[model samples]
Structure formats: structure tokens, C-alpha cells
Target: MMVQTGLPPMMAKVLVYLFTSDTEGLTAAELIQRLRVSPASISKAVGYLERLGLIRREREGRRRERYIVLDDIWYRTWSVSARSIQLGAGTAQDGVSVPAPPGSTSPISA
Candidate 1:
């Protein structure tokens, strides 16, 4: 299901493991071993989630970065989405005519 939702299988597994585990954070190496995925994959997913603000990374001592899931992650995610929708609605309301191609009506209502 996670793979279908645009997450790699290993990345999804790592996230699930983190969600289930009692630890508040996990290092990349620990996640890699637990999920049995390549370092590159873990790094890529971590980067993506960090950018999305779904997960946070804290720099532990000795150059290690620990990843954690925030309790308000969903609130942040939905807020971003809502903000985007507001922007889109505002743009649509700014007299931008819908450019309907041929017979199809444009989804963006004028």
C-alpha cells in the first residue's frame, strides 16, 4: 500500500517500523538494517519526508542524524494542503478565465 502511494517499499517499511517502535528516534543505519534497505533509499526517503515536514531530523552527537515522527505531523501536512488550496482558489477568483480545450470544460471554474 505504501509503494502504491509513491513510497518505496523499503522506505514504507522503515516508516512502519518507526511508527511501531517505542524509540522516539532512529538513526539512518538502524533504519536501514531494520528495513533491510539500501542506505541510498533510506537517505532519499528521509530527505523527502524532511522536505514535506512529515518527519524531523535532529543532529545527535558524532555526526549522526536521528529521524523522528512529530505528533502534529498530520496537522502540518493538512495545513500545507489547505494553504495550497486557498492559493489556488484565490488565483481562480482573480479573473483568470478557464482555458477550456476544445469540447472539454476546464476544471478550474471561472
Candidate 2:
């Protein structure tokens, strides 16, 4: 399902495994062992997911870096995105309230 949304298949598969597991988190080394793939693949996938805020990386008992997906993951993403959009909208409104530049034909000019 995630693969269809521009995610690499390997990444999606790794995520599926994490989602299905009853465990709280999985380390990259553990993922590599279970997925039977090279460490690079898991590293690449985990990096991408972390950047997108879909997952978080943390130390698990000082042994390894664990990837975790909190239950409120979606809510966090949505709230951050909504706040960004709100900021953009506020900037737009400010632009609208400003007088147009001299001799300008910009859309913000009324």
C-alpha cells in the first residue's frame, strides 16, 4: 500500500513489517537480519521515512538505533502541516493588505 505512494518497495516492505509487529521498535540491524537485505537498503529507507516524519530514530538501551512509529504519528504530521499552511495563509493575507508596488500589475493589487 505504501509502495504505491512513491515509496520504494523495500522501504514499504520494511514499514509493513514494523507495523505488523507487536514490538515497540526495531533497530536497523534487526531489520536487516529479518528482511535479509543489505544494510544500505534499510538505511536508505529509514532515512527517507525519518525525514518525512513518518518514523523516529532513537537509541534503544544504548545498543542500537531503533526506528519507532508512535500511535500519534499522523496527528503530528497533520498538525505541523496545518500550522505551516496557516503561516502561508497569514503571509498571503499580509501581502494582500499591503499596497501594490508602484507601476506594478501583480495579482495582489486590487
Candidate 3:
């Protein structure tokens, strides 16, 4: 379901796990262990989620970074998706209309 929203499969999985979990956050090792994915996969997924504003990375005194979902995870996700849709719609509305390809019955001619 989340994959349909432009999130990669791994990223979607990681994000969903973090958002649904009761714990404050999970370290990459823990995520890897729980998700059964490679270390690099978790790293990439978390980085992508963080950049999308869907999750955050926190550090303990001398411990590994943990990834946690923001308090308003759903709202943040919705907002990002809405903004993307808005940008796409604006671009579409601003697009130049091209002449219909030599077909005689088409009404799409610019």
C-alpha cells in the first residue's frame, strides 16, 4: 500500500515498522534483525525516510543512531504526498500542448 505512494519497498517497510512500533526508536541493527534485511538496506531505507520527513534519526550519548517516526507521522506523510501531487498538477497545467500526431480525427491539436 505504501509502495504506491512513491516509497521504495524497503523504505515503506521500515517506515511502517517505526510508525507502528511502541518503542521510541530502533537502531539499525535492530531494524535489520527484525526486518531480516541487510545492514546497507536498513541504512538506505532510513536515510530515504529521514529525507522525506517521515522519520527522524536520534543519537544517544555514545550509542548508535536510532530511527523514530515523528509524532505526527501520518500528517507529515500526507502533507508530503499532497505537495507532490500539487507540484505534479501545476506542472501538468503549465505544460505546452503539442499538436496531435498527423491523425485526422483527433481533437488534441495545439
lDDT of 1 by residue, 28-106 (tens): 9999888777899899888877776778899999799999987886687577678778988998777466565676676
Clash counts for all predictions: 0, 0, 0
Please, what is the TM-score per model? Answer: 0.65, 0.62, 0.83
Q: What do the candidate models score in CA lDDT, each in turn?
A: 0.77, 0.79, 0.86
The worst-scoring run of ten residues by lDDT in candidate 2 lies at 1-10
Pairs in steric clash, model 2? none
lDDT of 2 by residue, 9-75 (tens): 9877877777777788888888999999999999999987777677888886866788988677667
Model 1 bad stretches (over 4 Å) = 1-11, 80-110
User: Which candidate would rank higher by TM-score, 2 or 3?
Assistant: 3
Task: Provide the global lDDT of candidate 3 against the true structure.
Answer: 0.86
| Residues 1-110 of candidate 3: C-alpha lDDT, one tens digit per residue | 99986888999999888877789988898899999999999989998988988888899769789888988888998999999999998877665344446765543555
Candidate 2 — which residues are off by over 4 angstroms?
61-63, 74-110
What lDDT is reached at residue 107 by model 2?
45
